[model samples]
Target: MLNTSEHPWKLVGPWYRPSSLGGYAVTKTALNRFSAPIIQKYADANFANNLVNEPQHSLRFNSEDFVQPFSGDPNQVITPIERAQSHTPLKLYLNTHSRFYVVVCELHCDVAGFPQVERNKVCEAGFVVRRRVPVITPELKGKVETLLQQRSQLQNDLNKVNMQVKTAQLQESQQSSDISGLLKTKSARLFSGLQSGTAEKLTEKLQDTNGQLDQLSQSGDIKIELQGWKSSDLKGVGNWLPIEETPEQITEQVIPMYPLIADPTNPNHSANGKTLWFGVIPTSLADVDSNNNPRFDDADLYEIRCFVRRHHSQFPIQKNHTDCCGDVIWSEATEGYQIAAHFDLDGTSHRPVNIKLPDLPAIRNQVNNAPAGRGASARIIAPAESSLNFATDSMDMPQGGEPLTRAGQQICFFSIFLFFIVAMFLFRLFLPILLFIFNLWFLLKLKFCIPPSFQFDAGLVGSLNFDGSFGADFNASIDAHVELMTEFTADLAVQVAIEGPDLEAKFNQPNFSITVNKGKDNEKTYVDEGVLANDLGLMIANGINASDDMRADIKNGGDSPGLSSLSLNELAGIFIAMQTEYQDVKHPELAGILPTPDSGLVYFEKVELNKEAA
Candidate 1:
């Protein structure tokens, strides 16, 4: 225990958070900072200078002779601003890194007789900016430092739990592998059964190992890391599956309108997942025909079929479950369900196929979704279909034949002209209402784009080739196989995205809507709160800047102030509070070291301390 400081300073704290605009990857501890005047000066002069060095206003009149044109006494013309006057205006530069202080109720004396201190959680930090150092007041530093140390200690406990889970899995795998060896090596002796040994016992042991292996496979923790394999090194990989099953992971990912990083898998960067599928503008890509249409080849369609099935299977086929390809085989290896789809891309929901998943040898791997199910879902994980061939028909309003006007049971052309003039007046009065109705109809049609327009019959018509490997496009694979039912209906080619915990729908028009089902037993749909925020921000930011929201994005992308921009010292306070909250609200087992805070512990007098210490 440590002794309390004789005098304590009053201080405030602020915390740092990942700047929300760009999804900058930030850990809980890494936060922005702020401070009052005195502390803010210290940070600007010391911290920002260290990170980036440059003089301000030094080159005000570049080319020295320009000063000759203005020959007044400099002192008379310029009254020097007082330091206090300059500092009071609050020009704060948040030092992303700074610390705060806490109270030290306990003391341990070193050989020099000056006591070494433990942190004081109760002390007030009056650390101010503008004065030299943040007023750490010998005592506050002790407490803040101690709290930081304690937090480091607590995080270890959380890591240990994860490590324990990993270790247990490894041990189980080893035990099963050993049993498999025993069954193979000592088969004859084990089968003799003369000395209480029976084939059933061996079979039971084998089943146990197989079951263990199966459980481990579905454990969702087996992250198979692969070395970059060249064509030369593409030899048979061991019992481990092939890496060919991952590209579909990229397509299923939902990125918002934000720009994507090339090879975005690097751990250093954070990228948005729920992006619009039509992010690429119609004319922005490599090439388009005279009709401004891009091509989605038949080969791409076949390739997409193999992509979806190779990774997912066994999803529930209930109404609430994701709509998967009906013909694909279901297994634990592919953990998603299948559904029959029918797409009618002919400007009507008329053609429908018994949408079947063709067999592809790629059914080799499926990884678990991230923690709290952040990783993957069946809806967004479509089998890599290309949109190059999808048709983009223009929609024009219908025009009626010439009209006739009837007056007193006599229809005449001159009366028709008078009626037309009156009709124009009525149209002007109801134009907006008519537009609203049309837009509402289009939105409703977008919602049903998938089922009514995109399902196809996928049966082995007459001995189809079941071989899995083929060219990049599945065209050859389909060409080799034959389906008895040649007839099929096409509906709107809709897509879905399972981004993080949320799901969204993509219509052929490629506009987006929210997904309403999680395809789980409890029947939940992942809601997208970010999209709502994005939409509101777009409207608001657009109005504020008098330009497109994308322009606002460029202006604020790297320098956005985030939700809060406290002064440097204030940030330390915020982070401390956040860290404290993270500790306070953690599960009981997770909050082992921190004093169990409650109404009783809120006040100082209620806290019992070892006052007997010198």
Candidate 2:
């Protein structure tokens, strides 16, 4: 029996024969045991009898003129349909025989499409055919199961290795962070230590010393002789006249022994043609006696001595030229000529003595009273005994032993004071040397206290571990003993013809895939020990080498070490020599040292003369 709910089929043809008879009828029914006989009887007796008896006339009808039971194109192919589903009819045929007419129809069935099948044999046979049977052997199944289990184990091992690798990476990262922090701290400490230690102190000291030396150099006195005069020439001179006083004198006189021209405009001219010569008399004989009387009579004037001065304005004069009177001497102050010639008043020399008569009324009266024709040369001579007596009496000398003893005591006290001043000066001069010696000893002691070398350990240890992996597989197989069988049957006899282009279909099997993975795991750990110690050692070695080089430079008297190259004794000696030379050159008066004689003093002289002799 076919259940109507499961199989939906409809019947359309129960046509009567004659045109007078009614049109065909359509009904939906189930082919079940209860309704089957009634349906068959109606079709065989009533419908068939009417068709056989009345169908002598021909009938023509278009398929399109009738309403189709189903919608869509009847000629369209429907593929890949499921089994037992209903399909539309494509064509219908009618036949007549001696007994009755028959109707035949060509119909399509709905069957699922198979891409693996090449022909319609399966559909025609209505069942698949198998030539060989395919089966899974127990041994093969067991092997596959074992392989799967092994793969699972390998996956589990890989997971564990991944966890271990992650842990190692974490440890390495932490260790690196710690090392970086430690290095930062250590570097800061090293820098601070170097900044605050011996090198810094030494640099500061050197800078201070250099600054002091610069100040001294700038502030110390410098001696310059602007007048081009030697120290001896300036000995008794209070101050030099300005250059404006002697504008024509640009350079020092090269031959000062020779007298200079008295007047630039009149070099070869004298003051007057008539030369009035004079003689300089001794002060002892030129002054009056205590009685204010002349010491020599006119006849005794022959014993007097006198010098005459020459008058000339000519060059190339001899030192002792006596053509007219005596040697000529020039004076810058007087801007005139003088002489150094002397004569005896006893008439032993031919030179005339032109002495100016003393301005006394008594002497002038005696000269005027002389007889005009007597040829008597009246002269006045003062006594030297009275002037000597006055000088001797004017001097105040210590009169007794007590005053002399007091003077001696004063000299002793002054000597003691000078001794103490000298001692103090000596102490000051040697103070730098003493201090340098003390500092050197102290520094040597400190140097000896330090150890030559040092050792240190960081006490650090590190370890690391890591692991990882990859794999792929491909499998393909064909069944050798399996086949498919199919069968098909149809009751109606009909011919089918395919039209137009032949139907063609192409199918391709899907491609298989393979996956490849590449993995790598590597781990390394490093531990550095005594990093600080190594750095400190290098610093110390460098410092020691520098110190050694400095010491060698000092001992070798090289200027690389600057003033340190000089020993305390040598430095002291140099300072003392410089001080002595400075004093001698710039402050000879302070030391009671006289100026050294030079050629310039030979032409200039400074002296005090009595008023009567002037």
Candidate 3:
């Protein structure tokens, strides 16, 4: 009985049939001989470096496709090759017999049209197509009818002959292996520890082993063992390994080495490009996988090889374990007698081409100034509890102090009170006059407030005096504003107190989120994602420029012209502005974003400015 489950047979994707099995074998053999050795060694090493080789993808508790959120959606489906990307089928029709009949393929079903027998054979690497068989021709239909009869007769004849050949061959190969093993046992006896009679017995066993070995080895079923057989009897033993045959290209493949999104204009279909394709998947390719699959500690079993388009044709790109790293591989099916020897991928890397945007007022700066009263009206934040940007969202930003969770806060507040008391006692005891003078000065400062036109020391803000004098201030009022005539520069400092170099430890939690919702109206009403580095730099630069102008004015006998006055609110606002402008200056857009810095990767048509840290 014909066991049809393991129906190993030739398959051509609506393309031409191979002329003979010889052609397919020969082409593939040549390719294997030429390329496997060179590539196999290095292919694995390169694959292991990918992030996909990490444990995250294979975690039993985690969904491997977690990176692709759509995987969980009921409507989402993985696309088949043809329609997954832009593709035009290299279409053809096959006639296994003189008359074309349907031949169902075991592995695929998109194609099923062929006649039985008629010496149907796949002789090339990919069955080569001669011409498209159009059904429009009328006389061709008549020929098909006659050819069907011939094919039916041939099929019956082949069925009868195939049974005897296959069964006998299977039994022979299976039996000869047993016989060869027996010979090996007997042959080993000659080398055993023994006396004269034992030696004679051993020699006898050796002779027996040799005789059986000769019989078994010379048989075609046991061709490999024929190496030890008599030279004359070894004839045609190695002939089971077929001779190479001519080949033709039946499909093309390509791979790109960067994150590629196949443009999906048709929303009705899953976003796997517009057309489906029919071609071989490189995931099954041993060249790429032999080294890649086994050695990686947590490697992905499958590598997606996309048949994408660049110059308006299909090519293959190997998606690295990360699914993002890689270069495009170009492949095409042709009638020429050649098969893919090896996939030669030129290493390619993608860096986003420099993007330039003008520096606008910072929403992030305003976001940063949530407590400092920049006003919520200046930002375009959606209704979200949190944001992905660590700097923008309050709950996510890093802060490294004991949490003031009710009880914890009470403990901390008490400790702070005790600390100040101890500090005052020590100061009063050790330096009585100094303590008295400091007390008297503070008393005077409160009793007789300095005019708005005068300046004071910079105030610090965050925790460890980062409020840039008042850098990280927890109590900055929403209604605070600085007089334009005083030296009240409120420099904002992102206080980072590290006992050592442990960022992951110190700021691991959301320490910077303390006063996020403090003053809603004081928040920014812009959608700008700008940060504060450049904007703060600008404020400092402007301060220097203004001071120079003031000195010039003072030299001309102007009233208090040399004075550089900045109120605390004005300083805070200016510092916020600088931080906003400096953060998003993508190296290429230095000037437009803020005061143009000379150092970086772009040659601006405008003059580059000398920069100093803000």
Candidate 4:
């Protein structure tokens, strides 16, 4: 909760009142307290005392002091005209008691009714103070110096380590160059028939070199070693200190005066005029007791903040229109024109008068229609196929023609048939040549095709010769045997031809004739039982009687024996035999001359075999 007590310096008056009467009496007293003459007297006394006590130290004054008496003749005095000419209407010293006070005036008016003429009067006035006090003690100063020295030492150590890192990096670079040279040497020796012992020794040396390089790489990573250095280890390093509570944190309090109070006769009327208000307000109320009264000797009175409010036109100008209804209107609108001024006990004040409002309309338009102006157009045309149109008007053709004679038709038909026959014969004769040409062209194309970088070495290592001749001696012998073989001969005799002619008779009755044929057949059959018996004995002795009853039964649709009939030992033996056979077939030695087969599926198997061997 905030206290809402009226400020002691609040003053109010009507515009018709004299400056010396009523609330104006207090205003006159405050003005005389901080008058120019009084401020000058204080400044001059301080300047003289500072010179006598600390002559070695230069005296300092506010910028408003046009003529510094300490810088010139200590006895010299500056005139009021000279001070005004220097743009300093009032010359005051910050250390003087009058510097911390300020006067504010406000005007009030009625904004609800008809227009009326009224003098400007002061509605309210007040004074405020604000100041900064030193909180750094002697013990804190000693601790700060110690912290700074520690920081400096830490920086020096860091620089030393950085230098060492640079040196190590240079050494690593040289080692890298040496390793590169060694690699080149090793590659050359590997390809140039280097001895096995020498190559093995070089490889060992390279491994050791690589180990050294790895160590160098690990050594350069100093970040892990630096983990012990923590910023929290420094002095005065912790969570941020909370804001210290001060008396200046009090909220601004306003006190109403007589003019602001409602009166039955005056109603909402108020005269506008400037009124002065002044009093000593403590910048800090830390010295105040429980009774809300501050000790002037112990209270801070070097700074003050004044808040002033004045009434302005209550009716805002309507957008796109400018009419006020021809009447002045006023309201008790607390959110009126406000001015905040900060006055320090040191003769300086900070008052912000210029304020800028943001342009929201332009920003809103830009965001809503950023890309409204962008547009695009496109035209697409479909492709048309090439075409040809021929004109038939140029062609010469008879609309009607006479029929050919029979001979002419026969001739035309024969000629047509002959032309077809000849054409077919020529086609058949040239078909083989055309096919040969096409085949030759395809073969030439294949021969000229681009080849890949890798190719199989299918070239034969040696020439092959095939013997195709038959045995000449064997054929000659067969021909000689055929020449030596005898030929069959047949002889016929006609000695009784004349004698049989006399005995011959012809029968005329239906040419009937009886013919008697006489034939003599002589056949001799010889049976060699002994030879047959010998041949039978030899056939019997040479015959083989072999049989597979199980195979025969299976062929006849009988079930074969199952492995379940075998003992466990027997089954194990069979399994081992199968595994051994598989191993024998897949062994590397049986992989032919090449490690991989022609199909390349055995490449992984070969690789595994090599790995096992290595």
lDDT of 1 by residue, 1-614 (tens): 33423322211111111110011112321121211111111212242332112111011111111111111211112111222111111111111211111110111222233232232222111110001112234544575456435434433332333333333333334433575444323432322222133324433454554454345436532233321111222232212113333332322211111112213453322111211000111101123233433221111110111111211234433433322332211101111111111121211222122433322332222123224433223222122232112222375333344222222333212323334446755654443233232322122223221121111122222112212322245554454322211111000001111111112111111223333212421121213434333322222222122223233342224244321222222222221222221132422211213212110111111111112111
158-249, model 3: which lDDT tens digit per residue? 33333323333333344335754444333323212122344355445545544453454355323321001011233322111111122122
Which 10 residues in a row give candidate 1 its minimum summed lDDT?
486-495
State each model's CA lDDT, in order: 0.23, 0.23, 0.24, 0.25
Which residue segments of model 4 deviate by more than 4 Å? 1-123, 137-294, 297-301, 310-614
List ranges where model 3 is wrong by over 4 Å.
1-11, 14-113, 117-614
Clashes of each: 88, 20, 83, 15
TM-score, every prediction:
0.12, 0.11, 0.16, 0.16
Q: Looking at candidate 3, what is the lDDT of residue 229?
A: 9
lDDT of 4 by residue, 507-574 (tens): 11122222211121111111332322222222111111101332122112234332333332232222
lDDT of 3: 0.24
- Which numbered prediction scores highest in lDDT against the true structure? 4
Model 2 deviation from the true structure expressed as Cα RMSD, one decimal place: 73.7
RMSD of each: 35.6, 73.7, 34.8, 53.0
